[model samples]
Target chain A: MNTIEVKELRRIYKTNIGVIRRKVKEIVAVDGITFDVNRGELFGLLGPNGAGKTTMIKMLTTLLIPTGGTAKILGYDVVDQANEIRSRIGFIFGGERGLYWRLSGIDNLRYFASLYHVDPEVTMKRIPQLLELVGLSDRGEEKVEGYSRGMKQRLHIARTLLHDPEILFLDEPTMGLDPVGGREIRQVIRDLQSEKKTILLTTHYMFEADALCERVAVIDQGRIVALDTPEALKQVVSDLSVIEIEVFGVPEEILNQIRNLPFVDTVSVEDLDQKQALHVHSAKGSEAIPPLLSALEGVRVGKVTVREPTLEDAYVRLVGGKV
Target chain B: MKPGMMKAYVHVIKLTFIFTLKQSMTDAFILFGIFVQPLLIAIMALFILGDQGDGLVIFIVVGSGLTGLWDSVLFQSGNSITRERWTGTLEALVGMPTPLAVIVFGKNLAFVTQSLSSMIVAYAFASIIFGYPLSIEAPTLFIISVVMTVLSLVCLGLVLATLFVLNPDVQRWQNGLEFPVFILAGFLFPIAILPQWTTPLSYILAPYWAAVALHMSSGGKPDILEISVPWAMMALLGVLYLFLAFWLFRKMLFKARVDATLSGQ
Candidate 1:
């Protein structure tokens, strides 16, 4: 059974610009998007910034009414049966801002449990259990303001589960965290998936989507450009291999030369603070490496490796640009 | 509503109240609004109007106490929704199955509980430090009046809370609302002495009736039969304000959701 069904969902924001002489402009944040997630499936919405990922999540969560089309969660219409849907679903937008900073972790959970109308008997038993699940049982008495980013994110996960909702919407759950923090949250999400909970997760991190999502939807400019399982999506670039070259001070001219290679499908340069990782997708893989090295003859190349296609390569090919 | 749902609602309100109270107690600014400001006002009143009469001292004490309550209603109750927005919790609260108004109601109840300290601190400062004779001629009537007054004020706060959610600029009017109630509500003096044109406005205000009931009971000069009018007026207005509050709450909720204004999104 499909736990969520969205049909041509659209959102247009009318914002006023200019302080002294105002003018109204309509920005299409989510334009005619459609998708569905089956029960117990971990679905992912992948997009770059301003691609309406968060806006779409907000509409499904009933925090923002769509400008057109319709959505249903667990057989309830998002527009007309919002209250019913809310009771059966939980959502967490990435940030520590949602939890009361002054309250202890346990107090925050118990307080939200009452809001969700969990039975007192259940709450008393579940609060401690959730704390343990999130690895915060030892620090549940500490104020949330004192928690690390990872701990707060875990507490957020615990808070959303208080009602035991059937569907969870997580928008960039690991947006700004250390690798360890991000991995811990991913583990918790994996645990939830094992328990047969349906999740709709949005992230720009292609690897994270590839790792956790059963199916991934690549969205751009407020529309779904592609939707398929990780392996299938990666097949878009199956004929190509990714050549990652670590280089310092490789000028833009050299990068453009790599892009112009006859065998090169796409080339993207990611800044690594002090250096840049040059990703060159070519149908020639090992054969193209030598020509690529000569192309960077004047620049300092650190390490080079050729690998099979990844979701990032697939995303770049599908979106026609770097994500 | 089903019994089960009603029980859940009450449970939410109770927990929200306790948490709000606990949260406010630790904030030094809220503490000033609840206790320190009222205490200072009582001291100022004692010095400004030295020993004019026991009735006058009690008048200033009650006025100062009510000022604290008014401050809570103005700041805490009024800002409850906006604070949620600033903290990024408004979206979470709105997405809950429970009505946002109920949670806000619970929050105001917590502020009301803390505001109760204003009355106690005022009384203590007046009686202990100033040695002002503090006595209620009709103790039962005084207790009843105090309860009705707080209830009425809380209902008024509810109305304002809904308005704040709809028009946050209304919050700028907070300082604008305080002194008018202090003066026109007759917290410092009887409304009769005000310009006759202001009587109609005062008559409809719950605080005016509350003040009359408190003053009459404290003076011990009037029987229950005589003071019943103000008591009755306060209760009637409390019901009316509560009805208005819920109505406005529904309207604001619909507007906020439709306009995508909840959490100022």
Candidate 2:
């Protein structure tokens, strides 16, 4: 059975412009989107910034009323049975702004636990357990203002789990964290998935979605462009190979020259601090590398490697390289 | 409400009140509004109107205390929802099973609890430091008047909170409202002495009636009719404001969800 089902959900925002004579302009933030998540599945919504990922999550969590269409969570209609739906689900948006900075981490959890209507006895036992689960046991007594960004994110996770919610909505849970912090949160997500909790996670990190999501929905321009497992999505670009070249100051002309190559499908450059990683997608795989290197004769190239297409490569192919 | 839901509401109220109290105590600006602002007003009143009489001293003390209460209501109660929005907790609070009214009520209760300290500070300043003869001739009446005043102001704050949540630009009007209420509500002086035209405005304001009840109970006069009229008026207005506040709160929440403005657009 589906834990969550959305049918043609839409959200349009009207923005006003001009000072003296104002004009109303409508922007379709979440245009006619439809998808479903099975019970106990870790579903992912992958999109670029302002791609309506947060808007969709807000609608599912019953925070935002859909402009059109309908959604039901755990069999409760989001529009009519919001209270019933809210009682059974928990959500956490990214960043440290949601918590009361003056209150201690434990105090914050205790307060949210009551809001979620957890029994006092259950709260007493669960608060510490959740704190330990989030690896915030030692820092639970400290004020939230003093916590590091990652610790606050962990506390947010713990706060959401206070009521033992059956479904969780996490929007970019590791958006701004360091690698270790991101890994820690990913591990917690993995553990929750193991416990058979239904989760809807929206993220910009392709690898994170690929690693955790049982089914992924690629949303772009307020619509779902693709929906499938990571492996299946990656299959869209299976005929192509990604050739990555680490170089110091490769000129734009060189990139253009590589892009002009007959066998190259796409050439994208990523700034790697003092160096740059040039990703060359080719239909000819390793066979295109000889001409690609010869075309960049004078460039200071570091590492050269070729690999199978990743979810990111698939994303670029589907979204037309916007991400 | 069912028993389980009622229990949940009570738990939310308790938790919200405690956490809001903690948050207010740590907020430097809230601390200043609750304690420092009233203290300064009381001192200013003593210095400017010191030589008037003992009756005037009591009036100033009570007026300063009410000023603090009004200030707390204006800032804390009016801005509570907006503050939650800025903290990114408004969505979480709105998404909860518990109604938003219960959470806001709990928050305002905490502010009212904090507002009580203003009265204590004012009384202490007037009787102890300034050596003024302050007495409550009708102790029961005085207590009743104080409770009614706080409740009435909280109701007004509730309305403001809902209004501000729906139309955030109106928040600037809060600063505009502070002194007008001080003047119109007769917090520092009698509305009778102001003007013939201002009486109608003062008559409708709950705080004006609250001041009348407080003044009459504090032995400014022994007219039972004067005390009872304002007392009854304040109670009626409290009910009216509460009714209006709840209605507006529900409307605001519906509009917020529809417009996706719960987090303050």
Candidate 3:
């Protein structure tokens, strides 16, 4: 059975104001929707702003109740079995409201440790492992208030994993991190997934999603528009393939000649000082590169490379618009 | 309780108690002197009002103490939540799986314990130095304190906590509320001595009746039977507030389904 199963869930909030200045109105936040995540699978919910990804995660996590329909986590109902579900899963918010700055890192962990009811003996051992995993062993005794934003985020993941929960709900886990930190966090996620824990990760960064999630659900306008493996989703938008070509000091004639290649769908050039940033798209990366190169052969080419379709390009195509 | 359930609730209760105690110092200190300001006025009443001044100390104690409890729950719970929300910490806590009820209990319990302890200290100080014909009958103080805690402040905390969930802007409400609760709740002087216009406003709420009952029990006025009517109203309102708090929490949870922080799209 799927670790999480949701069926036609809905959440409607009332915003009342009218003749009485309090007449009720409904704001349907999560319209009817359905999906299931398998055990040990790192599922992803991809969405643009306000596409109901967070709403769905909150509902499944038992922080919110659905107005219509139902969801179950580890075979426990999110509504009727809320307490049970809360125990079975852990959630990490990419929110500023992450930790108790007043307390040290291990103190924060200990507090949550007590809440999880891990035996004191077991928790003692687990705390060190968690601190080690997050590379915070040295800082474990320091108050989180002094920690930088990235350091605090790592602590948040530790808290989410504290209960040794089988399923993890990570909402924009690598948000606001620098490239190195993001990579570090991505590696941590891979490690968690390797332990066979199910993670339903949400992120707007396509590369972040593509790198971590094996299967992804693309949500837009409060509904799931597309759900597939990252490669599968890319394949959906891979039809109009876009490739970037780098060239130096190419004249307009050669640029025009490259654009006129048989299979080269569209070509654009940019003059960056003495260099040109060339953009090309075709049905296949290999099919378009040779002809484009041949056209620019005599143009004092310094460096030439064929680019593959990035998930960013796929995302733009997925939304059918620009970022 | 199961081991896990026991752990969740124990953490809730223990954490709540500490939080309330720490928060109470800042809140009650501002008001403790306010709670006693009337007692000093009552000593002045010995010269101003003569024989009638005999029970004035109890009057101020019971009245201000009653209103103090009101102030503690309303101001602390509402204002703290609002302050934290603006500071951007409320969303972080609320995003967790732990119920909102847990957050309310932990924070308010801390404030309440601090208020109770500080109020006791303020009363002891006044009884020693100012010496306003004090009497601390154990059974009476015990019964009234219990009533004040359960039927008035804690119940009110439920409502205030719910308000925190939605609107954290409580300064206006707290400012407008304190004196009215003092005047109407009959905390300082008798609601009866207040002008007829003010009596209607003061006795209209549960805190007013509760203050009066506490005043009577604390040796300020008539017997317990005379205070029974307001005591009954206080108890009823307490239950009602608790029910309303639960309902409010349910709606907040439903409304806050999308953890605002996770707008990944």
- All candidates' chain B TM-scores are 0.93, 0.92, 0.74
**What's the DockQ of model 1?**
0.76
DockQ of every model listed? Answer: 0.76, 0.83, 0.24
**Which 10-residue span in candidate 3 chain B carries the lowest summed lDDT?**
B256-265
RMSD of 3: 6.6
- Look at candidate 1 and tell me the lDDT of residue B241: 85
| DockQ-derived CAPRI band for the predicted complex in model 1 | medium
Clashing residue pairs, backbone N/CA/C < 3 A, model 2 = none
The residue-by-residue lDDT of candidate 2 on A1-323, one tens digit each, is 58998999999988799999999989999999999999999999999899999999999998888999989998899988998998799899988788888999999998888888889899999998999999999999999999999999999999889989999999999989999999999999999999999999999899999999999999999999999999999999999999998899988888888878889888777887999998888888888888988998998888899998999999877776666
Give lDDT for model 1. 0.88
Name the DockQ score for candidate 2: 0.83
Candidate 1 per-residue C-alpha lDDT over B82-197 given as tens digits, one digit per residue, 9 for 90 to 100? 88888888899999999887898889888877897898889888999888888777888888888888778788888888887777687778789878888888877677788999
**True-vs-predicted CA distance for residue B109, candidate 1, Å:** 0.8
Error of 2 at A168 (Å): 0.7
